[model samples]
Target: MSRKTFIKGTLILTLAGVLTKIFGFGCRIFLSRSIGAAGMGLYQLIMPVTAVCYAIGIAGPEVCVSRFCAAYAASRDHLRARHTAVFCFGMSMILCIICTVLSYMGADIIAGYIFHNPHVAPLIRISVFSVPFACIHCLVCAYYISKERTVIPAVSQIFEQAVRLGAIYIIVHIAHNKGEEITAAVGVAGLVCGEIAAALLCAAIVLTGRRKNIRTTRHPGIEVKQIIKTSIPVSLNRLALHGMQSLEAALIPLMLTVYGYSAQHSVAIFGILTGMAMPVILFPSTLTGSVAQMLLPSVAKEQSSSDKLIKSSRMALVFSLAFGFICIIGYTTAGAVIMAYVFDEPKLSGYIRIMAWLCPFIFINTTYKSMLHALGQAGRVLLNSMLSELITIICIVFLIPRMGIYAYLLGLLASQAANSALSICAFTRTVSRITTHKPLRS
Candidate 1:
């Protein structure tokens, strides 16, 4: 893995990510228009549960597979990589089942208590079906990524988005022609269908293209205890981060309702903030995400050489900062126009501007977290994420009641900033320790 190869891999993955983001955002716009603001609100409202479940089922194991498989491949242990993939897939399936059951049973409580909308329970349950499919797709994609084969995942992403968008269009049109309430539920159905398609497509790609020479190790002499120990922290970190994010989704809307906003207004604001504004603000982050995913394994495989790790980490950080700044400026200048043109709502311009401030912090935080995960510092990531979320939640609790939607955005910005600062400090220290010794000879 020379720097040239690394750059080449990064470029392919980045291009893929950009394509995925474009398709995804396009889907968002179409869905928002199809469902209207209230429908979009209902659709967006249940997603926190979706995000948390998917993260719990997939995130840590996928990351672990990516990092470990890359290292194993680098060491010429293809058999180990295969075994690890098997173990990961198996584990993900089990988690998916558990999540499915829990989500179904707890949907009522989540809707009534968490979101303050008993009507949202059915939507949450329906959306939960996507969890296993998403988890499996992520796990398979991780293996391909570990092999530095970006094309498959890239193609799968496009396919997934196409399927999702197409389904949403047809379903929403039919449902809207009937009534708004049905349209909202139909939108959730579209999500479930899209996830199913994505999972099947990814599975087909992996099965069809996986090399025959890569043999699975029979009873690989690895300790399950060690694997679990290594994986738990990463899992818990993802769980905390995503859990908090989900909680925020539920809380923000509830707070808005308490502040005298109508249900429709609360939903509309949430949709605009999460679906419209956040996407625009975070568009520049796709580059860092692609690079970080690639860099994680690259860093782990080169862990013996601190210089290499630090060099890669610094390069990624610099790129993220530069990209984030560009996004901030671009969104600041053109965000309103884009919102007006896309959503036919110029009133959203303020929210868009405020949300754009989150770009730099979010990008930096993501890059830093990736670096820590690469270095097997999942506990640190967890602690930092929990602290940031706690701070943000406390702020939101105090501010949202008094200040309204703006307070929610402020809390988000503050949390991301805190996370970014902590990640930078931790990543700096780790890189310093790694680079203190001379680079190992290739």
Candidate 2:
């Protein structure tokens, strides 16, 4: 968790993220061509549900594991760090298993009622199986991240994306050869395959690595009470945020319909925005995302040192904003060409360019929230995030019907701007308190 180590971890994860994005773009291209925009839209509808499930099962536990593991490892308490990983892994696995069962059983209900589209039920059923594997992958990655050992996590990330695109290509080819229609369900199947592959790889590494390291005697241990106390609030905050996000996502196409587009056209437009344009705009965030992720463990480790924490936070914020502005310039100039040529969706160029304005806010928010979480400000993160989502929802409900998709874009930009401002204010206030008083303990 030294500054050098933090930079090294960020570089490793950034490289991995870039490779993953490459493979992911390939997968997306194939899916968009094979199943079309409406199909991608149908597939995107289920993503929020999976995200909610991830929040419920893994998000809180991952944060807790990273924070606690970093603290324990810094104290040279390897035994406790190992135990924390195991405990969180077990807890997350059970929760994910329950989510899998419920999602599978209730896929029809969710698609028909929540999404108001029965066609996505099959995708839902297929996609839910990825949750347990994803939980496993993330928890293992969290542990390694805490140890500042990015090699395993980085490798697993690339391996997963490679396997996913490969699986999708093969499955879609087989289906085409068999004279069967290709659909978004194939895309969901590929996702599950990728997760399974990544989880197995991580599990293998952890098992082999632990053989010589685990000790027989117990030392001062991390208690279940401590884990719950840290994880539950974080979990609830994430659950609420993700729940609101899910609602926002679901309401988009529905609101678009109210804007005068036919059902099919509305869904297709939704697909283009979420699946195509959004990805292109967010492509540069891999660097910021990597920095933010590495910052979490480092920040957690340095939480007792006000000077170091403040310095790191300031550096992250500045880097993210500077990089984001550069992205805005690149996207404003070349984004249209990328979208038009890459996806063969010339219509997406406008969306991409328009959404380019979100880069600074999005990038800054990424780093700020990570540092906030590291500082045990999950409640602030939750509140700021909720306010953003609420703004988007309000716009979707009232404005989309009048101004069309442009209104939604405006809402997104405004919301991210608002969230970024709020996050900065919170960080400033918290760190000012630290500077004036004492460093806060996570």
Candidate 3:
């Protein structure tokens, strides 16, 4: 976790991320053209279930495994680190299994009752199968990240995206040949295939790789307890955040309807914003996201050194600010052109420009949250996130009906700004206390 190693890992991850995003954009553009906005809306509607599943089964364990495994490996306790991964994997698998069962069983109710769109039931059924595989993919990646082995995870990412793009293309091509109408389920099927591919690759590497020397007969009872203890708060935080996001997703179209648009039109608009404009706006986050990925484990490993933590935090903050503003300028200049011509969605141009302001705050918030997680401030993170989502939710509920989509954009800006301010204030206070040799408070 030296500075040089951190930089190298960041570069590797950033490269991998760029490739992945490129592949992903290919799939996205294909889907948009093939299925159109309404179809993409159906696909986006079910994302809440996917996100909730991940929050339940992957997010918390992934963080705990990365943080604790890196900590153990720093102490040269490879056995403990291995045990942490195994235990977390087991817990995550159980949760994922439950999630899959519930989702599959209740797909009809979930789509018809919750989302008010029964057309998404098939997509939900197809999407649920990917959760367990995604859990496996995330935990394995977390383990590799803890050991500072970015190559395997980076490779897995590219492999997954390639498989996804290929699978989607093949499925759509076959359907077209058969004169069948394209649906969101085709996209969901591709997602499932990609997760399965990545999971199998990661599992194979871990099984065949040389960790034999670290094998032990000792039970991991204490480690399991520690993992659970650390994971619960993080898990709840993720679950809450995803839950709010799900609520927002479900409510957006409904709120838009209240704003005088037809149901179909509202859903189509939702699709354009989420699937088209937001992607272009958030594309540059690949770099910040990679840095955050590497920063969390590095910060965890160096938490004992206040100076190093502060330095790392500063570096991440500065980079995010500079990179985010650069992206703002780039998007302001080219975003409209990209959206209008590339996606063939002329309507998205204004939305992209408006959403471009989200870049700096979004990137900075990501880095600060990673630092907070390394500081074991999960509760504070949860509080800030809840407040952030609450603002968006309020706007969606109250303002969207009166002001239309512009209200939602305003909410996004306001909420993210609030969350960023809160996270920076808390992160600064926590780090400054460490510099003062005082106990850190959540």
Candidate 4:
């Protein structure tokens, strides 16, 4: 691959990132308005459960597919790369099916006990349909990303968002027209619709695209060892991390009630912070996230070239940190106006103001985590992420009642900052070993 390929890949992903975020932002605004903050709260509660299912279903293969395929592709082994994609798709499908079944069956327990809201069982069950389809989408996107063929994933992202928005609008309208309330359950249905549409399109692309693109090469590929080596560590890491995050998501609302707030009030507060303020806080990451994601394959491909690795690392860090600081400034300066204008939830402005400072930490940690995965140190990446998430959970567990949701915000920044520090240190050590111990070679 050439520099132009890398640049083109980054541009395609970045453009897609920007467009997706914009469309997603619009969706959040519309959803928040249609369902109200309390409904958003219920909706937010369901997402962590969905994420947990997704982590079980597809998270391992998603990263493994990208890293291993990139390595194989860089070696000019298209057959191994394609086989890896196929294998990952299979693994993801099986896991997602298992997760869907489990989630659907356990929806009552998850809603009543885990989420602390028995009323949320319907939404949880409804959200289960998204799991398998979402898993398929994840595997498909990772394959295209590894091959530097971003156009497929980019277009599919647009398709997903469009379908999601249209479905949501229609669902909300029909419910209102029928003189029924726009419950959060209806919101979950829209989520399922979008996932189904995206998955169908992605499977079509992956199948048809492969027939046109694949050519039998000498390399038959390792059936599953390499993928398993990477996936087990990554899977465990993500499962633990996201599982904790789900706890945090659920705990925050539950703890709010302990802080003397009503359950509805607490859920609304959680919804505002997550659904409204967070979208704005993370908007600028569209650029950095694309760069970080593309960096995985690029960095993996150039592992022996210290100069290239160092240069890529520096540029990603500098750009992400600078842009992240800009996000901080933007959110601090105009967060209130933006929230009021866009979401009409000016209450979220304070949360945004508090959380905006997390941008640099979040951005830098994201970039470095990708670097770790590219360096084949996914275990280290997972360790740091789990630590970060654990700290947030600690805060949510012990402090939310005393300090309110601000504690979670503080925990978010603190955890990200710590993760960034630790990951960068690990990355620095890895690069130093690669550069000093051996001569540069392709």
Candidate 5:
């Protein structure tokens, strides 16, 4: 794609992201208010598991499809692009189905042994239902994104958020009308419904819009091998990262209890940090994410240039740094006010303020990882991520008892800074050596 087309696609994604974020914030505010911190904690507790499952089932394949399809589509080999999608989609469907069955069957072990809460069992079962839907939706969205038709994906995102909110409103209040308090299962039901709607929407677009002239037969064996080859490394990289994150989620609340706090209080505190403050801090990251989305496929093209890669990297860097510092100033200036005004959690200003230092590095880290992944440096991405998460996990294990939540706050800053620095250094070296020769896209 030309630079103009890339910018157009990024802008479309950014606009859609902004709207989705707004609707998401609305859902958060209302959900928190209706269900209270305990309920929010319940939902937050399940997020790490959700992330892990989604990473294994969808994130890797979706990214592989996006990057490889764009590579194929750029050469005008539309048949190969279709084949990539089919192979990845089939892979995702099988994995997600297996995940769903295991999650449902082992919910008791996960809730009892892993999370130390029995109520979480039902919520896990409910949330697992969304995995298949989300996996299929991701593959479909990847195909459209590879074609640079951002409008369809954008519409699907908005539609999903709207459906989630509407479903939450109805599901939560129906239980209320029956004199029952809102449950985490109900919250997850909303997510499942939304995913199903989104899956259907994207499937309609991809299946109905195919041109008749495109080839009808593709070598499933060859394409499947190619897709898995690209996807497995990315999958393992993300799986390791998310697996550590899930471990961190379980550890955070447990370790906080050593600070002489009740488990309920610790869970509530975790909810505030993960569910409330972190989202606010990461709000502007939507732009970086949009650029990353566009960057992957653009960089995956065989004809992609060294100059173009460097230009995009530098642009993402400047924007991330400028925006990061700008956000730091905003959070430092009125974090308390914003928290109070937005999520009604005024006390979390300290967490937000402390985490402000992570903005630039975190944002820049996202762009670098995307560029590196498309550049076929999955091992480097995995190493940087593992190192970062390792640092955070180590700190949580050793220091949360002595320093309490402040330990986590400092650990996050240190980890993001470490990850970002490593990625930038790797990218810089890769760029310098490849200045006179094209880096391998695959």
Candidate 6:
């Protein structure tokens, strides 16, 4: 693609992502008001399981499809690109079904035993239905992304958020009027509905577009084995990363309880930090995240070209750092005021400040991880992720017990920093190796 087209695509996607995140954050604000801290806590506790399921079932395969499709298209192998998409979609469907079953069956154990909140089980089950929807939505979005078509996915995201927020308002209102306090569960149900709607919308868009570009070939070969080979390492990396994150979520309450806080307090604290503070602090990074998603295909297409790869990587890094810095400054200056006024929780300002410190690292890590996926260095990514998680677990195990909730946050910040460093190092080495063999001539 030309530079102009790429810039235009990036801008469109970035704007869409920013708008979607804004809506999502606004939804959270309304949810917090409707459900209160304790209810939000229940909502947050059930999320780690859902997040892990999503990571394992959808995220990895989606990226693999995006990367392979982009590379195949660049090589003028349209049939291969379509075949890869079909294979990835199939694998993602199988994974999603398995994960959904496990999620439904394990909801009670996760709620009662892990989080010590049995009331969250129903909410967990409701969220399970979203897995298949999310898997399909992500794969379709990846196909669009690989085709250098950003508008469809961007529009789909906006539509999805509209459905989600609208459903949440209606469901929560109905529940409130009934004199029942199930706002959190209602919120999750809205999420499931929205994801299913989005999946259907995107599927229609993709199928319609595919029909217009149909090639009457004797055989559009499906390379199922190659797709799985590329997907497995990426899948395992996502699994480990999400597994560690989930472990942190499940352990926080237990860790706090061991350090002399009640289950309610632990849940409330965890909810505010994860659902509220982290989202608020990282809101500004949505642009970078969106850009990184677009950048992956561009990078993969230009992987053998050192100058182009370096230029794209450096541009993405610069953008991520600049955005992260702005967020840090804004959040650091206005965090307390926003927390107090918006959330009505002045005490959460401290956690907000701590989490804000992690903004740059998180943003950088996200961009680098995307670039690595584009480079097909999934094994390296997995190793880096595992090492970072090990460091986090050790810190959490030792520090949370002795120093308390603050220690857990500190561990999180440290882990992100470590992961960012590792990603940067690996990315640098990969770029260097490519440049050395195939130098870009002036």
User: CA lDDT, every prediction?
Assistant: 0.80, 0.88, 0.89, 0.84, 0.84, 0.82
Clashing pairs in 6: none
Q: What is the per-residue lDDT of model 3 for residues 164-185, given as tens digits with 9 covering 90 to 100?
A: 9999999999999999999888
Model 3, position 167: C-alpha lDDT score:
99
State the lDDT of candidate 1 residue by residue for 288-340, as single tens digits. Answer: 78777777877778877777777776777787778778777887788667875
RMSD of each: 3.0, 1.4, 1.4, 2.5, 2.0, 2.8
lDDT of 6 at 12: 84
Each candidate's number of clashing pairs is 1, 0, 0, 0, 0, 0
Task: Report the lDDT tens digits of candidate 5 across residue range 151-223.
Answer: 8888999999889989999987788899987766767888899999999998887667865455556553336
Q: Predicted candidate 6: what Cα RMSD to the true structure?
A: 2.8
lDDT-based ranking = 3, 2, 5, 4, 6, 1
The positional error of residue 327 in candidate 3, measured at the CA in angstroms, is 0.7
- Model 4, residue pairs in steric clash: none
For candidate 1, give the lDDT of residue 158: 72
The parts of candidate 2 lying over 4 Å away from their true place are 438-442
- TM-score for each predicted model, relative to the true structure: 0.94, 0.97, 0.97, 0.95, 0.95, 0.94
For residue 421, model 4's alpha carbon misses the true position, in angstroms, by: 0.5
Q: Residue 429 in model 5: shift from native, Å?
A: 2.6
Which lDDT value does model 4 have at 269?
95
Q: What lDDT score is found at residue 359 in candidate 1?
A: 84
Model 5 misses residue 373 by how many Å?
0.7
